[model samples]
Target: MASTIISKDKFQFTDTIREHLAFGIVLTCLFLFLTSAYTKIEEHDRFMNGLLKVAFISHYAWLISWTVPVAEIVVSLFLIIPKTHKWGLYGFIGLMMVFTIYIGSMLLWSEKLPCHCNLLIEKLSWGEHVVFNLAFVGLAAFALWLIKNNQYKSLIKQNDKY
Candidate 1:
């Protein structure tokens, strides 16, 4: 019985470590996006406008360019706050999905790919962009899994009380 309890505690400790790792991954991603948005706002805006014009979506290009950075900042804030973390993860996933789709589409159909994020990110090849986005998506998915698992475990414990 004592060993069983010790094993249980060890399991919980491991789970906690995983949870913290997920949180750290998410926080790092948040900072990455925020810094990318901040450092290249003008270039990003210009690139978006140019790409949209080329894609024939000129009407909304300006709006999207201006809004994307603000959205990223807001999402970063959400990820930093525990009460808002899940929502932040959702936002992060959505943004990454959109970015991935855009990069994928450009790679698939466009003659030339346009990058407007940051200097470091702009250097990534189109394929690398997809890989990078996918990695963040994986992180977000893992965080979501941890959150759901903890919630489920808590629910089970609550039910066991009766």
Candidate 2:
């Protein structure tokens, strides 16, 4: 007995957009996992200086405790699976946008000689931080642009010629 394949025309190019965005988002977040671990060992002073930056915020510790590592881990897995990749990209974009804002805030407030926020933070000065985040924002914006122009979204706008 032989098995036959059937095509139902379920959804067009949904997988492509998901793959592109997922690829970008996951590779981007990989920087986080590497940076977090790298700074702790390779450079201590910069790391300490960064923590000093956030030390005054009462909730900072808890935020770090739960948000950073967990987000890094969860998103990594979520993005790896094809079924979850689309939604995962959505979540990743949202989180990264929010992070860009935080980076912007740090740059704006640097006049007070505010701490850099961590050792990895030392890798980029205030000006550098803003530039880095803007670059990330640009990446996400491009992904959105691609998604909007994608076959799935645009194909839906066309008339069936059959």
Q: Give a tens-digit lDDT track for model 2, residues 35-147.
A: 65454445545544554566344346445544654664566566567556555556666766766676666556544444433355666766676676667656655655555
Q: Model 1, 1-162: lDDT tens per residue? A: 999998888656355776787788778878887787786575775667565854744578877777878888889999889888888999999988988887787777787555566665777887988998899899898887787787788799899999
| Backbone clashes in model 1, listed as residue pairs | none
Q: What local lDDT does model 2 show for residue 16?
A: 72
Q: How accurate locally is residue 52 in candidate 2, as Cα lDDT from 0 to 100? A: 53
> Local distance difference test, per candidate?
0.79, 0.56
C-alpha displacement of 70 in model 2, angstroms? Answer: 1.2
| Candidate achieving the largest TM-score | 1
Give the range of the ten consecutive residues with the poorest summed lDDT in model 1. 49-58
Alpha-carbon RMSD, candidate 2: 9.6
